[model samples]
Target: MTKTLALIAAAVLALPLAATAQSSTDAKPAAKAAAKPAAKPAPKKKPQVTRRAAKAVEEVTPIDTSTDVTLNEADLAVAGRVHTGKIQCELGADVTVTADESKPGYFTVSTKGAKYRMHPVESRTGAIRLEDPRAGAMWLQLGNKSMLMNQKQGLRLADDCQAPAQVAMSAELKLNPPKSLFEGADAPTSGPVKK
Candidate 1:
């Protein structure tokens, strides 16, 4: 009877240990499943555009490929009033650039007391461009107006302001002239004398 009782007790103790071992083994698989990384979703493919839709879109936007534009001397002449806002200078002043395109291929630019003679140079655009190498200045003519830029000083004067009245060269001369040489009657005479 004692032998049978001892065998039963041993089996009872082994039952809890076996249950724990089985539970731990089962939990290992669950833990591994939770730790596994999820698979990535497949990349989405772009929807194909119908041929009719592409043709309709192309018809809506037309491309211009004409290259017949030309710029001539007349286009570059600074004839009309061209003015700009206050120029950023040392004294912070406004400047007026007057161009006389009377002479082809050559033009005169006047601002304040300074005058620059410019000549046309090759430009890649339709705008007429003139340059004064001496002063390092450039004049870009756009339609009826022009802009003056100083390359050396890195200054730009746009043709956005209202130009003042055109100053006549003759009027300026009339206003200010040199002192009269023949002030008195003792004027020097130069001529061929007949004996």
Candidate 2:
């Protein structure tokens, strides 16, 4: 009878411990579920900075820059025979524009155009050679710079003067007082070349 009672006591003690362990195990999963995060999707990323390789893909192809220009008769009547209306130094094929410290933000180049408005420099001496053909150059003191013109390759004032006389020369066909000033060339001849 004592052996059976001891056996019963052992079983009674083990039963509550086993039940407590089982209960804790079952409660742990619920607490763990609350502690842990739900399944999360991946985050989207922003665009990074563009590299040189990416810039290469974005870049346009290169192109040829040189062009040969021809002059028309109407282009001739312009002041000083220069392509630019403003009096600026135009660089020749051989010339280059360089930066200068004394005159910052401005450029210095040696070049010239085909024609010029000659402002004769008068002194005790007579007219010197304004058009220096040895250097194929002419000096034009134009806005904030001096123009050193090359006359060898293209047309110059000297070249234009040397044009065919019939096309180049200008003649004034003046009429006599007896004539009406408004009369046509076929009306009358009162002077030398016109007559």
Q: Count clashing pairs, candidate 2.
A: 0
Mind giving the per-residue lDDT tens digits that candidate 2 earns over 53-96? 12122111111122232324432232222212233222322233
Candidates in order have lDDT scores of 0.46, 0.31
Q: Estimate each model's TM-score.
A: 0.31, 0.16
lDDT per residue for candidate 1 within 1-195, as digits (tens), equals 335545544554465588689888898677777778755644655433322222222222222223232336454443222333333222333344444456544557655555566666554333445667777676664433345666556655443222332224324545864343224233446779555
Clashes per model (N, Cα, C within 3 A):
0, 0
Minimum summed lDDT over a 10-residue window in model 2 is located at 120-129
Clashing pairs for model 2 are none
Global CA lDDT computed for model 1 = 0.46
